[model samples]
Each structure stands twice: as C-alpha cells, then as structure tokens.
Target: MEPPRDAKLLDPTTQPARIRAMYTDPDFVRRGLGRAILARCEGAARAAGFRSVEMMATLAGEPLYQACGYAAIAPVRSAPVEGVTVPLIRMGKWL
Candidate 1:
C-alpha cells in the first residue's frame, strides 16, 4: 500500500518499510507471539538498511504497537469497507 498522504516522517523522501495484516489468534493473545513477530520484522527491515518502519494500526492493535515503541505520526483515518468504516492510526518507529 502507498504511504499515507499526510505522513510526517523524519525523512519524507525515504519511504519506510511497511508492516501489514498482523494479528494474533484470541487463544494465543498475551503470549508474546505478536511481539516476536514484530521483532523479527524489525530485524529484517534493519538488515535491509531501512531506518524505520510504519503501519496503519487498528484500535485493537494500537496498544501493542505503542508498547513496542511505535508512536502515532498522523491523525486517525477511516478505511471504508462494505458500508462500514474502520479507524486506523498511522504509527511508526525508528530502527
């Protein structure tokens, strides 16, 4: 997906790596599984010379991202789907 139009990054010209569609099964919640996945992704991004990472987070996932050191970088945006809207926050972290 393209970067958000109103993204405010440390380097606007440098496109940060993106993480998408991350989730943990309800049965596996609180098992540190999500954090492990995020660590691996961040490691790979850093290995590839990326200085940062970003993702559009659902309200349910926002707490985890914040706990992992990602901060909100933009205002909440609505994603329309089948006549419904999902609130998403643009969050990012420097590697």
Candidate 2:
C-alpha cells in the first residue's frame, strides 16, 4: 500500500526542497568545507522560498550546527539501536 501523503517524512509546503548529507572528510572537513556547505544550503533554501530548514544531528555535530545559527527545537526519541538507546537533537534555522 502507498503511504499517505502526510506520512512522507518531508514537509511538503517547503517547496523546491533540498536535502544534504555532510561529513568532514579529513582533507575537507577541518578546512571548513562543512561550514561552507551549510552556508550554501541556507542560501539555496532562502532562494527557494523555504522559511526554514531542519536537520537531525548526532551528538558530535550539534555544536557545529548550533554555532552556525541552528537552534534545537526538540529532543529526538526512538527505540533502542544495538541494545543501546540513543538520543538526537532536532534542530532548525530560518532561511
């Protein structure tokens, strides 16, 4: 059966939506590639008419994103992974 429209994980009203997955490759990350990528994404979101953008962050990534203006909106919860319950932060920024 097909999933309900709203059941899709993304926000539909966020037109021209963009998704990015970033990591600091040893050669790229330490030199500020991640920050540059985030800045580009935010600019693209604004140009696309998105009022905001959202991201889920692992504990290690939280500080970086926060420093770049993303704010925590809520704490993430889910069933255990590998017998260890993990937590994540739901973060967002206005474009």
TM-scores of all candidate predictions against the true structure: 0.82, 0.69
Best by TM-score: 1
- Taking the tens digit of each residue's C-alpha lDDT, what string does model 2 give over 1-95? 33444544545365334444566776665578789888988887777667888877767789989999988879986457567766778788776
Summarize candidate 1's per-residue lDDT along 1-95 as a digit string, tens digits: 43466564444338788888899999999999999999999998888778899999989999999999999998676755566777899999999
lDDT of each: 0.87, 0.73
* lDDT for residue 69 in candidate 1, whole number 0-100: 100
Error at 43, model 2, angstroms: 1.4
lDDT of 2: 0.73
Which ten-residue region of model 1 has the weakest summed lDDT?
Answer: 4-13
